[model samples]
Every structure is written in structure tokens, then in C-alpha cells.
Target: GAGVSQSPSNKVTEKGKDVELRCDPISGHTALYWYRQSLGQGLEFLIYFQGNSAPDKSGLPSDRFSAERTGGSVSTLTIQRTQQEDSAVYLCASSLARSGETQYFGPGTRLLVL
Candidate 1:
């Protein structure tokens, strides 16, 4: 893909259900990130993977929120036991190298938990 892309542009799930959000980053990007944007709020960092290093998951809000990047390209974010508070736009971004580099964003996945 020319840029990052995410699956299921919109998702609606009931409380306590689980959902998986996928992200396909640019071919050569070495850093991938996941973020959450609540209504009317700024982007909140969720997790990020850099090269072969351990992913920085310090930003994930809870154990229910987890993500993984495989083969250094595609990533998946899984939210378990979804809650209404978790309803938001889940965004994915990729950068050429480290965390501070400029990132290319994908169309976000809007998750609505009812």
C-alpha cells in the first residue's frame, strides 16, 4: 500500500465483546503505533513497536487493550471485554525509524461499544 491502511473503518460491538483492529503500514516503515481518540479529545498513545525491540506498551490503558506487530509490517490491536468508555477512534501510524520521527497515519477505525 502507498500508505498505512486499517480494516473495518467502523465497528460496533456490545459491551463485554471483543474486537480486533488491523493495521497495514507502509512497506519499509520500522516503527508502528496505535492510538486512541475519544470524542472531542486529542490522540492518546496506546502502544508502539520499534524495529525488533520490545514494544513500548506503557501507554496502553489496561490489560484489556493489547497489540502486536508481526513481520515488522502489519499490526493488530485487540480490545477485550469492551466497554462504552472504550468507544472511540482507533488510529494506526507508521514511521521510518524511531518514535520521534514523522509518522504516516491510516484512516482510523471508529469503535462504538454499546
Candidate 2:
């Protein structure tokens, strides 16, 4: 009955450091998604997981970004060698069982890289 939730509502990291952001989806949700919203840019799809299917990672900006869903409930987005340009609000969302379903988003995690 709860909405999606993310951890460390805010993060400030130095360049070249690595960070891991966590997401907890609503109970029983089979679809989870991660997105990035930059200062002036629209939501940028990062990745998503649906049931036991393979995750679609085509939206990841580079090899430095990756994510994984464990036990079909929680997920973690890892950014290695973070850069200033990587600063943005990381949003997590979940839907019933598919990508196009109505998504419930979490209060995004604001990440600032110095």
C-alpha cells in the first residue's frame, strides 16, 4: 500500500568517487525503473526491471552506470568514478507489471558531485 521510496534523499560526493543509491518499490510491484533528471533536462531513462525478465539497460549513459534488482523487490543504482556532470536527481518508480503501466514515483534523491 505504500509508494516507491529511495534512500539518502540527498547525496553529495566528490569527483572520482563511487556512489550507490537504493530504491524500495511498493509491495508486490513487478516493475521497477530508474531515471535521472538534470537541472534543465527532462527525465532520462536509466534502467528498469520487470519480473524475471532481463533488464533493459539501453538508457544508461555510460559503462560507469549500472543497476540491479534483487529478489524482485529492491534495487540499487551504482555510479562509479562519479563526475560533476553526473549530478542530478535520481528518481525511482514502480508499476504493476509492465513498462507502460502507470508508474508511481518516489521522492527523488538529489545527487551533487563536487
Candidate 3:
């Protein structure tokens, strides 16, 4: 496919464990983002990286959630000391530019913490 894609379609972990989710955007794209949706809640933005510029991390809820985009293509989302409350479907999106850009989403990666 020519769209965004994610790995570890599903992940199961215990409280206090750590997990890493991955996203691969379309080639040549310069902007990447990470988001998540909890049960019955709306999608929440986590972080975004654009080109060689400093990453835009204002949307991250806490320091525990972090992401990095390498070479303007692949991105990894890491959750440290996972908690049950962190259970959610993680989504990744990518676009060419921030202004007037249309993001393309990848199949979400579901995380379950017990």
C-alpha cells in the first residue's frame, strides 16, 4: 500500500512493563505523528515530527510517552512503565507539510495492559 502502516497490530503487556509501537509512513513524506484512543474516548494526539525540524511534542500527555522519527520515514512510539490506563489503540499518521496538510492514517496498534 502507498499509505501509512503500523506494526505489532496488537500488544499485550502487564502493568509496569514497557512497550514500543512502530509506524512507517509513505516514502518521501516529511511529517509524522502519533495518536491514541482509549475506550469510548476520542483520538488524542501524542506527538509529531516534521522533517529535520525540532519535533513538536506539545500534544504528549506526559513524559512517559515519547516518539521519534528517523530519516523522515519510520517512527517509533514508546510507552514506559505501562499502566492499565494506557490501554488503547495507538494510531500513526503522516503528511507532507503542516500547513493545510491532509494526514493519512495507518491501521491502529492495539495495546492491552493488565
User: What global local distance difference test value does model 2 have?
Assistant: 0.94
Which candidate leads in lDDT? 2
Q: Which lDDT values do the candidates have, in the order given?
A: 0.93, 0.94, 0.90
Winner on lDDT between 2 and 3 is 2
lDDT of 1 by residue, 1-114 (tens): 588999999999999999999999999999999999996667899998998999999999999999988888899999999999999999999998953689999999999999
Q: Estimate each model's TM-score.
A: 0.94, 0.96, 0.94
Better of 1 and 3 by lDDT: 1
Model 1: colliding residue pairs? none
Top-down lDDT ranking: 2, 1, 3
Candidate achieving higher TM-score, 1 or 2: 2
Give stretches of model 3 more than 4 Å off.
none
Candidate 3 lDDT by residue in tens digits, 16-77:
99899999998877988898899766798889898889998998877888888877789999
Model 2 residue runs over 4 Å out of place are none
lDDT of 2 by residue, 51-102 (tens): 9999999899999999999999999999999999999999999989853679
When 2 and 3 are scored with TM-score, the better candidate is 2
